[model samples]
Target chain A: MMPTEDIYQPLLNVIEFLGTFAFAISGIRHAAAKRFDWFGGFVCGVAVAIGGGTLRDIMLGVTPFWMTSSIYLICTFMAQMFVIVFARSLKSLDNTWFFFDTLGLALFTVAGLQKTLDCGHAFWVAIIMGTITGSAGGVIRDVLLNNVPVIFQKEIYAMASIIGGLAYWALVELGCDMTISVITAFLLIVAIRILAVKYHISLPVLRGEE
Target chain B: MMPTEDIYQPLLNVIEFLGTFAFAISGIRHAAAKRFDWFGGFVCGVAVAIGGGTLRDIMLGVTPFWMTSSIYLICTFMAQMFVIVFARSLKSLDNTWFFFDTLGLALFTVAGLQKTLDCGHAFWVAIIMGTITGSAGGVIRDVLLNNVPVIFQKEIYAMASIIGGLAYWALVELGCDMTISVITAFLLIVAIRILAVKYHISLPVLRGEE
Candidate 1:
């Protein structure tokens, strides 16, 4: 299943680009923390921003959206620029960046779910795809930077995506318009993520025998 | 291009299964070293064994080979069994495992190249895909384990795949049969990797300004 021509495509593209920029910035921050060179940081950022969508697109049997569009690449470059120019004051800007990152995750989750639904997959598969689109990039970034993936840790990250996906599913089942359902899902994810962080809510750590 | 129906497919399947087994075992060994539980280890092993091929298949806009085949999952299970049953003597079996891992890389590189060529891609693209098939799993494993990727700082790993791909390309250009070219290229990768490890030949560490 592929995206049919849509009059709303241009607006959707804007949302996608915003998400890409924030995700890339998050990736760049991690790479910089690990002292990767400029080129390495840029590559890492691109990987983080586009990795999930690329995987989803491949699974969908379409050419990767990033490969077809220069905008995503340019967004990554801009992410690198943000890191470079704000290097000295980044710690102070953490909250601001975190806001954008959360918004990006929300937007991406909506996009992922809508795309999967458009492909005519079942709800459960759509949930998984939406979660992957929202969180896989961060997992890849953590891995590349030699850190335990945050998703597997105490952060309520992927859970937010799952819950948000269910919310979208429920809305669609009730005959909600596609745009309204998407926005509802997006807001749900953003609100969940923000509240989780603000309240320091976390899943219990798994205990394995030493 | 997709796999044409071939009489020799059984033999190819055998090679692919062998490679998957070895790759899975390599991933399991890493997981064990990190003290991950059996379930964690099994998951890790499966990720390493099929991660590269999955990526390649998706990029080529085909169903991931593992999705249609049970053999790959079975092979990962066998790898876990080998690890569990041989736990006491596994450390001493490192060299034996290394041999299989090298063989896996060689076989996978050949498979990747053939698939890319079948898809009507140019030789350079085939080479890149071949290297990805051989190396991406290890990169993923290293990242998941919070270790620096060996590909970024190791013995002639991806280089061997590149050189082997070049050999295959040259042989085909000179009118060699596809089977012979694949075999020669596979052997070349195996030999180079083994020799590189035996000689401790590593790429120089890149020094970035601290």
Candidate 2:
């Protein structure tokens, strides 16, 4: 039974690495558009990939991951380098970048939910963490760039993460297989996000007077 | 005894408001430098004054203050308008701004430490929260302006908060009067920060590698 569980761990780790790479790439692309130097681009990529998780861990009183493992840092650096080397070619694939970004966002939400559950938190707390994990890196990225969060202004970003987390919770309550539940949650997030973007769905803004 | 405590509460509330005003002014001054619009300047001012404490409260599973009270928002807007009206004169009084910034940092740190202690956290946790409440606002400010945190790179800013926290903790452990301990801690932070800035005392950088 332990060996069976360990088998999936490697797969999860691979998915995590891929998600990090995709997220870092998105950050690098944004930094390039902002005309940042290589060092600035690298920092932005690393911060966007790890900022949310780092804040979560700090709040939970856990040691931050990047302080213990350099793999995340290395991956971000590679992502930045890749963008720098292939800037012109990558510029033509805006849609592809969006796809990767959405995929990474979904994976991050699932990862955050799983981590919070593993830490023995309640479902509501897990859902909140999932949304934070999915959206906070982007929030920090925008803040560091001196802009309002895109989620606060644009498509249904955090709403998708919330819906995915709820779906995960519902499936778990129904005693679905953990793997299937996780995959379903990821799909729900990606699908909702894609649909929202296509249809331009948005949350009602909190009016100043309200 | 109860009546006395209630009487003092009003005084404490006034002090808190004053501190918040000073902090908002510092933020507004910076926003003026950046030439942000009225709304942007107001948002920045409020964020700089309350951002760290809001984060601390959220992490501690408490309601954020500004969400509970509109006074902070109003104060920030007032600060922004005041700065806009007096931008030219204010720009000439750099020393006055620095002094108010130091005073605001000190008072905010004490307020944070007190809140954490009231929440029944450990001394170390209180110290950490105090430092977070004092310095994290400016970190957010710098990040929002697309710059590295001045505290992280420059003079002993965070160090002042930490030292003040330690002083508060030590005084409490020694059974000093709570009000006296709090006031002493605040004064210590202000003095240390001002002296550090005047003397150009700074932390050694971790140089050598990327």
lDDT (CA) for every model shown?
0.80, 0.76
| Candidate 1, chain A: TM-score against the reference | 0.91
How does residue B48 of candidate 1 score in lDDT? 88
Q: What DockQ does every candidate get?
A: 0.15, 0.08
- Prediction 2 TM-score vs. true: 0.58
| lDDT tens digits by residue: candidate 2, B1-210 | 011256578765665666677778776655555544454455457768888887888767665555445677677767766676676676577686677778778877887888888789999998998888887877776666555677777769889999999998999899998888887998899899988888888989989885
Tens-digit lDDT string for candidate 2 (A105-209) = 888888878887776666766776788787778777777666655554455777888899999999999999888898899899999989988997765432221
Least accurate 10 contiguous residues by lDDT in model 2 chain B: B1-10
- Best by DockQ, which number? 1
Expressed as tens digits, the lDDT of each residue in A18-77 for candidate 1 is 778878988898899899999989988988898888777767676777787698899999
Docking quality class, candidate 2: incorrect
Per-prediction tally of clashes = 1, 0
Which runs in model 2 stand beyond 4 Å of their true positions? A1-14, B1-111, B115-210
Q: What is the lDDT of residue A35 in candidate 2?
A: 89
Show pairs that collide, candidate 1: B1-B119
Give the range where candidate 2 chain A is weakest over 10 consecutive residues by summed lDDT. A201-210
